[model samples]
Target chain A: MAADKDNGDQEMSGLLKSNFGRRDFLRTSAAAGAVALAAPARIGFAQGGPTINMQTWSAAVDTVQSHVNAFTEATGIPVNYGNAPWAQYRESMVTKFVGGAPLDMMWVSDAWLPEWAEAGWISPVDEFDFLMAYNAEAEDFCTNSMTYNGRQYGLTYYTDFMAFLYDESKIKEAGFDAPPATWEEVVEQSLVMKEKGISDYPMMLAMAQESWLIEFMSALVFSHGGRFVDDDGMAVMQEKDKGAVEALQWVVDAVNTHGIVSPACVETGELSGLKAFASGNHAFAMVAKYRLRMLNDPEQSQIAGNVKQAMMPKGPNGDHNTVGWMRFHGMASQAAQDKARAESTAKLIEWFGGKANGAYTFQKFLFLDIGAGFGVKPLFDDPEIRAAYDAYGNVDMIQAQQALAMKKDVVTPWFGEWNETNGSAWQSAILGNTDAATAVMKSAEFWDELKQDY
Target chain B: MRRLFGYEERSAAIFLAPVLAVLMGVAVFPILYSFYLSFFRIKLTRPNRTPFVGLDNYLDLFTNDLFWVSVARTVTFSVVSVAAILAISLLVSLLLNQNFRGRRVLSTILLVPWAIPYVANALMWKWIYDSGYGALNGILYQLDFIDKYMVWLGDQDKTIFLIANAFVWKEVPLATILLLVSLKAIPSDLYQAARVDGAGVWQRFIHVTLPAMKPGFMLVLIYETMMAIRHFDLFFILTEGGPGNASHVLSWHIYVETFRNLSFGSGAAMSYVLALVTFALSYTFIRSLGRKV
Candidate 1:
């Protein structure tokens, strides 16, 4: 009986071992099949190229998406585009960059370029072959705006400068056949327009706590033969030669003494001045050249077809200098750390902004579609582009003149801090809460502190 | 060695391991990291250079006038907005608790402001407060409230109040819902007993209803105060701490320090100060409530 039991146990153990071995073999085969199925797809993706990721604010979402789609179609490399609202864009970008997220390229404003490049947050593009294809005008502009410590970090995408957009009908009603030639003439014409009842608020100035005020003040100071920063790159607002105080005084007088500007100007944001001018409630507004399209659009502007652009009125110093704003596409240093990805991103930027394809570039399309001015000279001189802008009456010339009048070598790494401090000081002065001289002095002090911290 | 905990305790801990890990990653780690960062001088722009600054960031902030101004503004905003929210919420909850026509519909409708996205709500209020073409100016002019349109956001105090009102409009809904739930939880027999003792409407409310809703009131007070003190989006969109830093609060100041100034160390220090103040206030309220209860 014991021998019979031992034989049965041996049989059971052999059967169990055989079944386990068979199951293990089946499982191993299934795993190998799964790997075989997925390996080709993964390898294909790897060989295809690294996907490019770009970030910007909502303002550039449409332009970026369209250009990214075209680039992807031309090259099988996929691109990921992300955007946040303008208010959150700076913080979001900084967080993503500092968090070691995968950001390849981004649209940075001219004001932020200095700080970003100085801190080595962006990769220098001077060595890229595609950079050599930029036209002299575009290259000079980009180099002036994007160069930090003599190394280029960006490619110019779009350019906008502050200019005077006036109501032609109102100016004519006020007995002025031409735009004001000087600041004095501006005040005189504004008073005339007010007396004629053509506009309740003859001057629409955006004095809100935004960069608009800083841009306007910079233009004013530059036109007055003053600079925001000295040769040493220190804020020179308190310097007597820098007309910051006088320029700010003019802004305050426009609101308080002249009564030509609205008391609510302190609440006006970037677009509010343009809207106020477009609504036919103001005879003149100092705004960016980008407002040309909106001013000419019949749906958006009540004064459509009756508005015209001109260079900013000259200051007492007899200079026509204005504040130039440019937007650029910059490569992230982290993205450029990988040579292949860096090459791809450089190609994408060249396809977007370079003259390699001439009029076929994304920059040209952007200018034609939205009336945005290209940083490239040839595009600006193109007959089709000129005609497209001429439809808006001398817009092309006005933008060119504004570009020529841009203050040279004024931007500093502390541009953001300078803007905020000066904006608040000017806003307070405009609201009659503080004197212009005192405000400028206070802002200078704040700038000094900012410099110390940096 | 003998086991410190039995199998049941070990099993419970094993079951909670995932949640504990998540909390450590999200909450505990950030708090610890921020505290560590507060002792160093760091700038997001200058990522490669971070030097230990010890308590300089905190000392500098305490000496900074702008920091103090923001703290004062935040305190005032919290006090006024929380008071107004509590009053409006209590009244709404009392009204909703009573049987009325369309009570359910009204309760649901009250939540619309709170349901709307904060950005959208802020934009709406910005339009309403617009001086030139805003609905507020238009309606007030039509109603003959003023001879001319007033710039509501231009004045510093008016801007703060307008923001506070918008905040109350959004916050009162949740407060009302919580208080209403608390009101409902009170037995009807207690009200009957109060009525049998000849308690009038006001007396019944003070005697029985108030005592029952004390916990709910304390919760609303604590939550709303914290929310009001950290106000950022509305002020950012509406006034941007503007008309000369009149509407600036502690959170916006921290944002300026961290993002705009790129001074992460200073921002971290300010955050700790804000956290400490909030914790102190919350503890005080809870402790006082505990004594009362």
Candidate 2:
């Protein structure tokens, strides 16, 4: 036995000498050691049951994990929840999908759904019988937004719409009795606030290079009675009837000509505007309804009780229109390829969006927790849900109505590209790099080129 | 075990296998695959519909005004950033090479910015450059530098420079360390001889130190130029190539085309174009610098 141990020790030493040779090897070994040390601890799960994996942004992870845990507890199926930041979520999803990783479900933005659905990355929700019941409870716009090529591939889990969130005290300080109802009133009231020093910038517009800016612009275009695309699904921002150029010009004029908005508006993102307004520094901000949660949070907001929500201001054309940005829970096509996994994923979807179980109630409560509008119709009419927003004075109801009323624009597969191109032009115009009409016309040509590729 | 090849050859092959595998998997395969994909009309959103469209994608990119604009911006960014990095790093290296008290401690601490992750460094600088409630504006305001806070990122002309400043700050430490190592390697005897020969301080530096540090200086310049040309994270996090494409670099545009637009063909073609430009420029620089060295 001692001889055998000696032989083993000799072999180990020989192996080390062969593999790790001197200074260069030591450096490489040190790097490998550091990498190993930096690696996260491996999490172990029980061995027997089918496991479901869900990917989403980190912001939704906790809420998603809670739901996952409840589903696992009731069904005895293990679940793996993966999350990345909003910036990395799309890349992660695409990598996982292409790599053939077993992803059961994922939360995708509405803008990304068409692309994923068209690519066959996600399965159609119509294959499951539970969707009929689910669709019955969901709002038409929400359900319609998830449908592509006559097939539903996802269910709207959280709904948001653009609304005018304002600091009531600031507006009152500017001698306004009510929130602005027209573009003219908005400019006038913003000037008043600026003049009175109630806010350095009276309005916070999301002009950052992000989807939020595009969404805001879409609302602006819609409010001006403009369609983002023509009936042939071609970009028509250059068309005179659409008012797209006019919508962009108004935003530019607000920043450069009127100077009601500070140059800082060019840096404001969706959340940044909300946070700025919540700091009691702005009279008004055009932001999503979900920001109400942060603005209402006593710990997170200074203007919690002093803020009010109103419908988006009308445009020069007197059009009271806006757009809805929806997020949905989609099942992976790979998961649907297998019978058992498909059934399990469908059940998970039902538990998240279907009205049969208390899952829908829990989902509504979760949306309410974040001050987001739910896609289901009954939740809006729920007295308890309605009463929860008493502090904000019926903003929840207002958002719900707006979500229903807003036009669902740019739902096609090319929406993402179009939005990005349009956003760049608008940003240029806002920054005075180019005129609004010139920017829109140039962007329109780019959009037309992008359309050909699709 | 019995070796199939000679002992030295076998050992060398065994030792290199892992690294070669890693290189092939991570670098070589992706490059070849990207080149292949560039010839096809591929969209990530239409995976099954990819069709062969050789040269069209490249033609489209060359013709596109936005692509050319981004290339120009990238060149401007690289030139300015590389110059700034070289000057600052050379100055720091010179200062740190002196035999002063706490020289070692200062040298160690100087790597803090380099040690921080690029994304984290970018986020910190974003806060510093923030138009509202940023340290830069706050400091300026407190000093009565301006009546109101200036939005540093809002202005088109300043956005690229501001991001370039952040990039230089994060990059200077590595360049400094590289140049400092070269500086330290210069023989004290050379400086002693220079002084004895009646050379002034500036003359001694020019005669004795500069020539000795040429190799390291060239290395840092090449490395930093490459880094600046292919810079992605700093632009992505700080400006996102924006305030209206004012700071849009080639890499950022490539990323937007590839990932955001899901036009993999166009993105890959642009990336190859960028790669060719970088390769040509780097080769030219190295050849010229090699002659000098």
Candidate 3:
């Protein structure tokens, strides 16, 4: 009976296979249909199309989408567009990389390239045409931003620098003509503001999360002539570099001794940082250029015209430093599942980055539409763009100050991961959970742990 | 007729096959694969290069102090949290079993914390523990219960306590659910018989309820212990295992090794070690109960 049953089952299986069309034709057809949907993408790219994904909430969203339409009409390459929430963008990209999902191109923060490249998560561009097309003014692009493993990883998408944002009216109310130019002067003027009770919170630092902390403190450390991390992957802080420790101590003193920053500042993250500054609760914040937009927005900000941007205070080392940071949008090398798609995507990237598309994208879409107002090299000198920015004379002066002074922090080969690892520890120190020395030591420990794995 | 020990041959095979296959597929295969991976240098970072390294990762991890420290931390957190969950859940289940008004409502309320997403729960608790504008400090200050703001989540030394508190709050409800189900399963006749024999509430609980709920208790213990080991989201959200690694647990350490450090070999090795440790703890629990499925 068992032998007969086994023979019967085998015969039935063979019969079923024979009845199925053309050796799994249905499955093949389904896959082919999906590919057919993707065929138009090739057609678009062949005509010099560029597809882009941007953060949904960013000011640049509408601008980028419209510019994509224009670029497609001009170049005949269809632009594919997608959007991501700012909060989830970083984690979403990581998921795509891990899952090998179909994301041919995307945007990433400048700091992410090193770790991404090290993990072989992105493709290196060596083509001269692509480079020339992507960033024609390559030298003007922040040198430290794009260089990874001594190779150009991507083109600079936009530029932004942090400046000291103060209430110009508040300063004037405190009988000052302008913002303070030195830490001592800030303390003195803040004390004056405190006595007059004009500003409840004289100064505020976004000491909550490490991302802002690193940006704010790097500028401080660099002004004092300290290297954050050395080439061998050792944190220079471990060596008790005079500049780093001094800068850290100054921050600690600013919190504990001066009592200028709110105690709650320790628990505040980036959004909260922006909120505190915009609410007129704080007199000064080391903030990026885009904050002015929020301050000017009537729906979101309470203190509009009162806000003014100023150069960051000069350190005792007789030097002032600033850090300009921004996100970079590009195509992912790992995005291509096969050769044809990869070729088409690469060509699209080249086209989008080239002069005909690049200038339009930056001018019409990114800067104007997004209200990002970030200046790219080619469009930096555009009269209208300059006029829009120069309308606020104080902000214009601060932008000029930053351009002359700030350096993009070295994107260390492993710096992206370092940010993830040590960024929080830096916050802890400022929050009074740990002292400056222990904080640096703990940061060093994290660095060392990462180094071993590297 | 061939004297087959009277077992229903077809029924027996059908019952065993599913469980046997599941045990092999989900449990056995992964364990074996992890063990194999532990011996080699597999990089989660560089997925393309999975070259084998004989015991180098293991040796490196063994020598690494951070790994050992995290292991110690994980063990401590697991033991403390598991024991607290068991004790609290048992007590709560006993209270709920009493005939009382609003018992069901209270039980439903207990389920709310478990229903909450881990990230949301973390944020809620983070606010409660916030130093400056948090509910705890705010109320304390308003009521003049304390003089100066105390940073509950801010202190490194106190972070483990905060994390444990969150874990206990979340897991006790689940443990209570299991224990309550087990309690309900015990026959009322057993308790009535114990009462007739002049048994008190404590005595009945000791003799009848405890013995009857052994399987359920063991299951809850095993599940909670595994969860305590594997769960990194809450810690990642609340502490980022920081204030200088004071709160860094094994899972978080493994995450840093794999994702942040991008050392696939070391990350794989650490993760395998973590899995092994979790397995050993679970196996010990199962063996001590004198049970297998």
Candidate 4:
């Protein structure tokens, strides 16, 4: 009995001694762990429902889940989700629509709006008064997005506009005080950067099919004051402006004359270009704002702090134009619930655009450019958030400049049929089968013929 | 005792009913439904917009340049890939039939490429063919074999060839394995007898092994052609039929027209056309091989 009592006492003393010795250390670790765990808790409280479906980019799914978790915490909602890559998402959406399956809501690219609306697949937002309530206070959100054809079809959750990301250290080493302010300067700086061996290449633009060319062409047309369509929506290729043509010539020269970019640019996709820029192989890359998150991740990036984002350079018109790509979430046509439920869902959309939620979603999922109609205006007002945008130095300023100068794509009428045609023309041009002028001209003619039938 | 027409009709019915029911439910229904859909003006996104258009969908497909072009490409691709695979497999099988050192190790290694996933294999080859900093171009440049990089999959004219190369590399291994199995099954006594008669390696192969492996060759031809016809992943990952639709096959056209464009009627109609072409080609191939074996 005495021996047993003595052993218990000794065990108690050991526990006490260890606790005393590591109190401070254990306290700090416990606090850090709580902060980490708090993220999921916050998510649970924000989302009130048991589940909601979302169709977001595969790359951005994790970032979205964090927000969804926070939403659940705030509102006691649960989220059951499915995700698809951007390319496959279109196919899946079509399949789901055709099969008449159960779907609550899905991410809709702006390019999909006209088709979805014309097809009558998406529900009208005007039926729910929640949008109007939010629109009154946040006019910027409604005007810039959501409002298609005078009636709002959906709400914008996030937007990403294209911009140039530069390695400031490399550029400074090349004797440039600031980023190239114009297209001419971009070319000159690329050559200069290449000559000094600061970087083996000056600029990297994604020239692959579908994704990059769509953005690149939009930037060209916008900066050069070329319009793809008239007010009447007739297909017009106003190459007479010469500025858009100059942009095309710049791309051609970047390949053949300047040789600043690697021939691999023609083969690289957006994600690959993001990888290359984050690896410090290229000094500058034409990319969207979303790349910032990947660049910031220490585990995935080697040049984390060395890179910065900036607006794409301007043309002779002095306007640095970019292509603004926005994604909106709309209720499925099959979701014919009560008007009150839709109003509640509409309120959820508003909540997504609300200040706190917007800040959370943008800082988390939207690491690059802020989507309009959300809390971008208020989120940018916070100095800490602004600083985060420029952690690599002046990136925020450059992105802001570009966003201010950005323009919407022409939203081609025949985008459905001839989407692959542009890639074909670009590839043909790159392979020396035909020159850029011929390719662009031929695309213009094709675009016209395509619309003629429509 | 209740047999009719020299058989137990009730017993036969009892055995066949379940199988017939399953077939009707699984196979015949879907085929008939697809055929039914092909006759409508259906849009995937607008399911309610479907209207019976009789033979218009098929007629429209016939007039569609992209459709006809994709069909031609699919046929050409199927023929070249099947023929190349068969030829390479036959040669490899012949090589493997010989008694050689470390033959097992070599045969295993040859099958490794086939074991990998098709998409993964295609991606691996894509990286190798990458014009900028791809391993293949990098090595070629180092060796001074080429002055500059070539976008192997970027140019439309070269894309089909690149895709074909990837397919052949992936497929030849399986064909070789199958052929090798058949070759081994050939009676060694025949070879011994030929040898006794002063028959050389070439003569023994031509007279004995070749005759024994006719069934295997035909099987490879049928399987490879069908596989080549149904392929979507290679073209999807490689070029997506670019440089002006040079590599775009009928399968991809069916996909784009159905989903991307959301014209399900047209997509279904195109798919039916693809199915018919494949069936006809497969039939012709089997017919030409004859049935003596």
lDDT of 3 by residue, A135-226 (tens): 54543435456656666655545667767778887888899987888777777888888889876558877655445667776767766556
| Model 1 lDDT per residue over A1-454, tens place | 9999999999989876877587787998899999999885575355447788888788646777887887778776778888889777877887887888888888887777777776767888888966755746573554577667777777878876787778888888888889887888889999988888787779888878875666777777876777756767676776675647777777788888988888798888878878878888898888888787789889999999988877777778647767776788889988789998888888777767675345547677777767676676666667787787787769556755656555334466666766776777777787777898888889888777777866
What lDDT tens digits, residue by residue, belong to model 2 across residues A349-423? 776766534547555657655666777777766777777766555745574446545535566677777776777
* Reference-based lDDT, residue B121, model 2: 95
lDDT of 4 by residue, A261-288 (tens): 7655666778777777777877888876
Lowest lDDT block of 10, candidate 3 chain B: B40-49
What class would a CAPRI assessor give candidate 1's docking?
A: medium
A best-first ranking of the candidates according to their TM-score comes to 1, 2, 4, 3
Q: For every model shown, what is its TM-score relative to the native structure?
A: 0.87, 0.87, 0.78, 0.82
Candidate numbers, best lDDT first, in rank order = 1, 2, 4, 3
DockQ of each: 0.55, 0.50, 0.23, 0.28
Model 2 Cα shift for residue A12 (angstroms): 30
Question: Model 1 TM-score?
Answer: 0.87
Candidate 2 per-residue lDDT, tens place, B96-196, comes to: 98889998999899899999999999999988988877899999999999888898887888988898899999999999989988998998999999999
The runs of at least 3 residues in candidate 1 whose Cα sits more than 4 Å from the true structure, single-residue gaps closed, are A1-89, A99-106, A127-135, A139-142, A334-348, A358-360, A407-410, B1-4, B97-105, B181-213
State in Å the error of residue A321, model 2. 2.0
Query: Model 2: residues >4 Å from true position, as ranges?
Result: A1-85, A103-105, A127-130, A133-137, A331-345, A393-400, B1-5, B14-19, B99-109
